[model samples]
Target: MNVNGGRPQLSGTFGAVSSTHWLPSAAAMAVLEKGGNAFDAAAAAGFVLQVVEPHFNGLGGEVPIVSYRASTDRVQVVCGQGPTPASATADSIRRLGLNQIPGSGLLPAVVPGAFGAWMRLLAEHGTLPLADVLDHAIGYAENGFPLLTGAADAIEVMAPLFETEWLESGRVYLPDGRPPAAGSRFRNPALAQTYKRLLREATAAGGGHQAQLAAAEDAFYRGFVAEAIDSFVSTTEVLDSTGRRNKGFLTGQDMADWRATVEESAQVRYGNCTVHKPGPWSQSPVFLQQLALLDGFDLRRMGLDSAEYIHTVAECAKLAFADREAWYGDPDHGDVPLGTLLSAAYTEERRRLVEAKAASVLRPGSPDGRAPHIPEQVPDVLPPSRDHWMNQIRNGLPTVVRAAEARTDTCTIVVADRFGNMVAAVPSGGWLKSSPVVPGTGLSLGTRAQTMTLEQGHLNSFGPGRRPRTTLSPSLVLRDGKPVLAFGTPGGDRQDQWTLGFFLAVTEFGLDLQSATETLAFHTDHFAASFTPHEAHPRKLVVERDCDPGVVEELRTRGHEVELVPEQSLGKVCAVGVDRERDLLLAAASPRGRQSYAAAR
Candidate 1:
């Protein structure tokens, strides 16, 4: 199957929004049309994603954004990934008789970061009022939007568990005691009221847009919302993926103490472009590392999706991610030698490991003589396919609840306004079945704490007020000190690998955004997962089925543990680019799952 022709890349002179879902894309474009900047449009679209794609993300989730403000010609990262509760420690999990934090449950929850992070963006960078920014989301929640097939299937699979063990979740997901039908107009009046109350509180506390957004943040972290969350977590116990009931560690104090901060991005100059990503707290820098390794290779000549191209890129990803397991963590807790890691000298040495044949092992280079440190009891099991359970539903109707596992599957948005502002943000966690919904609030706490380690001295080990090294990395690219591209995807460990391919497609092959997105891609499980159980499959390469069969055979001949996935099932990527030379704005979305879309004027 040829993997190239679908809709053409979207082009315009005004603005653009490329998101994992259609409705949010439209919502963002609407904001841009109303004179909102990229930040405001992104915030508005992000809130709508919480309402429509609750199984992937929610208001109770986290958002890590990398953006370029055209006015300042600067790149910045907004860190919305909050820390674990103060009481959460290695000892805390040991007390629960668990070796690793379960993938889902209150024990794995952290302070909800999405709301606060969005507010910070609005307060600092946006032009729209809080109510105006959130109006689309609130309207959708109160009235309705068509339920996604994937979300419906997820609810169907977890409905029984919610009813029996997480009754509050059942209240929201299975209103009227049944999973909402796919394509049905699903409404969550409770979540609508929750936002309405937040807006009202903001209005009560405000004199201006920035002040009102600050008040909204206060409402979420310090006022009635905090009290409700504390009450539920302190009093209730629920079964997690580990099959044991546990109480959460999050408290009102944790919420009040936590706030999103802006950080300098990790970046690298390759060829004519500079790529920027969030710090070690996220998996962003790994993409830069991959680019550094590929600097010596002629990727354009190797050709897109060819065996040589896929093999080289996938091998480099394995090496970079290996370093992630050994070194990347919240820099607030320890020193991360990012400068040395991204140096040409270091990457050249690491690139030597990529062989003509795929290496059937995990090889992480020593950055500054630091041996890669993996936890002793990390899970090495294979995870369920991202599409496995979703396929079980019949006729787009609800299916039976059989299993509940924490997935790193998230959502992404990319926006570019006429004013030169570009934003790439990944909002994830608080998946519908991850934790019980807070009573009276259509929200669930994030299971990001599940990514932390119990092993002492590990960079990502659990501790009070320490952010987990999250997999939610977003990317922004600048050319000759000017903002140009914003891109990201939604897949657990594969987020970096997929976006790396997309970037190379643009910079190397000179494809437009849509063609770059449609180009076949490949991923690897060679490094440990960033989610619970943290499994690793040394040298395994999963390629999309649309790739040439000859290339697939050649990849196998080279010793990769090759696995073929259904076409367009690997990454739900979206991207937007500003063509300064042409004075045109460009956007594109992957056709995978038929949900991703690009909207532009």
Candidate 2:
């Protein structure tokens, strides 16, 4: 819906924020408009998201950000990825008789790092006072803004996912136990107070941004923040039932021990542009593999919207992701050969296997691991249909759609300013149960317990002081020796699919940022190991209301199970680009969710 009607006018002076929710984007861009630099805008945006996108980023969850400092030409990768307490190891859990992980247990929550990550950005990159940057979030929290449609939908979806106490969620969500109807104002004085406290804490650091950041991180993880959380979690029955000693590691040591920094980038050539992503630990390398696999194709002759082109892409994506699922994980814990996977020689071999006519049975072609013997085919599950005449499956089978919704994920935002400072951030985490805000501090600890595996020997197995392996990867791409595109989407497994589609739409097919953002999207569910995609494909592809149905049918005939979703169906994705020749910044933000905004000074 160009319901935002027209993009705000652009000037040489530019600033913007892209996120799943509109309000946060607006908050960040507004900060930029008022002279705050990229770091200031991001911190402001992060706080606002904690309110508007509460389900995605409460004080409880962690954040991992990749930022590039233009002046120094150095890229700093902040891990802010959370760690399980020094106490709760997979070996510790195994001492008990229970062999399987409980679906809703609290034993796995790790130390969340989002707040600390924000603190560090302010320390290293920002010039403005932390309190000043946080002012907008505090006001929004205390004064209440009208509920946007997106917020309302997220709440309705969250009802079945969170525990009863969460019905309150302080004030960002429902105060009276009902999600605000669209357009209702919502304010949580509790959250407002929390923001105010952080501002003071930042000010007390009494040194440059670095000292202030260190202090802020300490305030949350190692100091008063951890103590308060430990107390609140102690009162919760979920903790007792999960059979954990105390809340996993929502403590100071976990935070104190935590270190978020950028890893080395995997460099791959994408035609004229050079592709870069932090490797092995991140699945971003898969994008490079897919593009490389398709390098031999005559994309220009395939016609941008034709079925043949879509078929090859769908098949190529499945092939790339099939490799991802079998190989990707924490490199320190797993044996993912990051360098070999991106090698041109390897990708070229994989591409030769793709038959020009028939759909190949999808499978993991590369040997990234030492698991087994034969090459195997990955199965494709049929997408579900809401209009199916048969309500129940044969013999009373339960629906996969219902099963998958139990695993909703959030979105990613990537912004590059004219000054060349940039950020790649993914925001996520939600629970049907309440994550207690450590008592007096009122900060809810993140429930990262499920991210770990119950098996003691698996690389990603649960462990004390180890960060759970996550699917939250946001990547950056540079064309012709300059950063041109920053893109990502939110869906545990669907991330690769959406990102792949958007990239081809822009780089190979020449679509504008808006068209690429609005283009058809689908994913192979291999990562989740279940066929439940956010939207079933072949039968489903999120398209604008104006897209032709015949086009949808053609996609289905070519092996894409197609279904039509809401106009703004795909995850909200925003990107900033440069018309390198014109020296103009091009930015676009999705109107899919509430409170999204972008501004160019």
Candidate 3:
């Protein structure tokens, strides 16, 4: 049906790359053309995204990666989501006169993990030198690139705060004492210099590729970058969503103590494909849980985008996310009953909850006879309105309302090389609007700690050195024990839901990547959000305006508070896959935001 007009699904035998921005996609393809594999291409593209999509991600952000290496014939997850500081306890936070963690400023800062995670990927799997992988990003930061309208709008919206409270940010974003115009060439010399210095130090101490990568990691986590972060965070008190200024708890020790780890992926078999995700620490498992529930239904019989299909998917999402709020947390800190959660018996028990009409309540089931517990402070019902500043800080993504509004969210990258290796990564947090730019560093600390709750004994309760259950999730699919597809998107809590729709379209409805990406998208905000204030809009089902009016009305009649957004406003999904049977690489990117692109040789 050419739902997305004429955007071609790129296919090649050499390599394919798809990312949230054109520059990153180009950079990744360039790496592949230069003989780099999927892992190397992914690392190169990831760094460039930190430069071009500053409004969406930065050096201080977090990224959770799912990759399939052909050599090992294994699917693994890289845990880039950093843990809270050793001093950041629930008691310490409450002592600061705050019930919930603020969404912005230093109080919610964690040990920045993006750089470490990328370095780990490169050192363990990549063949290229650190300098080679980072060159494209450094060039963009130094020479400047055309500013995205969304980035410009974010700067404009935060200009008052920058000028008054965050002077360091003003010095960078407000280059001429004002926000740069959209489409104008914008540069971040400070960021460029930061990258250059890291490279120089790495080169000076380098022995080989691995040694240089290790040196770069040390430079960021234990050397000058750590020193800068420590000094700034300890000395500065900044305004946040709590309506007060607070100093951060993070220290140089926190950064030094943290390292990205490669762990086994959580998997669930659906039809012929075995879907994999990160552990319960992230919201990744919700994807598998949803699939488990849907495995009972014949979605092909229900048809695509039909009222029946939308209802079933939305209901399953609500149930799965309820489990996320009740049970998902860092496995390193506590027990997460992932095995029981994905069990077929549990699936059948939960699948029965999906009825003829929409369920307006948030229902989390008992896994293995264990009762579910959510934070007591989290409201079951949505409030009419919230504080403006609190709303602004929720997801760290920025939005500016105008005649043609500009909104920037997270970033996604997926890569596939001819060697059968594939990578899917979602890089988010540390947005320019989320917190003040640290002095001397061109990046800001992430507000991911805001996802932690103060409710003690709860699975996701706040604790020192504990990892926050983040919303950044990436997906990888394998058929017959071979990696075939890698895909992800850039919505915070809605990430899994959006990508689930794309996956179902392809696997169940026989749609191609581009067509599946353009399919009408919908998600239920029926569970508490992972962001600060953790609000839930009960029974709310938001669909793109392009959705059939009949379907929208049907959902409303079934007890959903249907809200319609503009066309192409839901998810910016990017994907890459290998047609193993045909020996071809395939790639596609969402055309919604006019930013994401797909490239192939």
Best by TM-score: 3
Error of 2 at 412 (Å): 3.5
Q: How far out, in Å, is residue 499 in model 2? A: 2.2
Per-residue C-alpha lDDT of model 3 across residues 540-586, encoded as one tens digit per residue: 98888788888888988888898887887788999998787788899
lDDT of 2 at 345: 74
Q: Report lDDT (CA) for all predictions.
A: 0.84, 0.59, 0.87
lDDT per residue (tens digit) for residues 1-601 in model 2: 2322334423344754576666677777777777777778777877777766554556667666666677776655666667677777655555654343332334556777778777777777887777767888888878887765545655554443233433234333556656567777877677687777766886887987667767777776667666666655445544322323333434555566776655666667878887666564555667777887778788778866566676677667666766665566577666676566667776776777665443434466555545521212222232353522121111011111242232235556666566877776776543223243344443455555554555555545566666665666676676655676666666555666677777787788777776666665544432333111112232223333444566666766654545455555555556666667777766665554434445555
Pairs clashing within candidate 1: 157-401
**Worst window of 10 by summed lDDT in candidate 2:** 391-400
lDDT of candidate model 1 versus the reference: 0.84
TM-score of every model?
0.95, 0.82, 0.96
- Candidate 2 stretches with Cα past 4 Å from truth are 1-12, 91-105, 153-179, 239-250, 356-362, 366-369, 372-409, 430-443, 526-568
Clashing pairs in 3: none
Assess the local accuracy of residue 306 in candidate 2 as a C-alpha lDDT between 0 and 100: 61
User: Higher TM-score: candidate 1 or 2?
Assistant: 1
Error of 1 at 125 (Å): 0.9
Q: For every candidate structure, what is the RMSD over all alpha carbons to the true structure, in angstroms?
A: 3.7, 6.0, 2.4
Please estimate how well model 3 matches the true structure, expressed as its whole-model Cα lDDT.
0.87
- For model 3, state the Cα shift of residue 45 in Å: 0.9
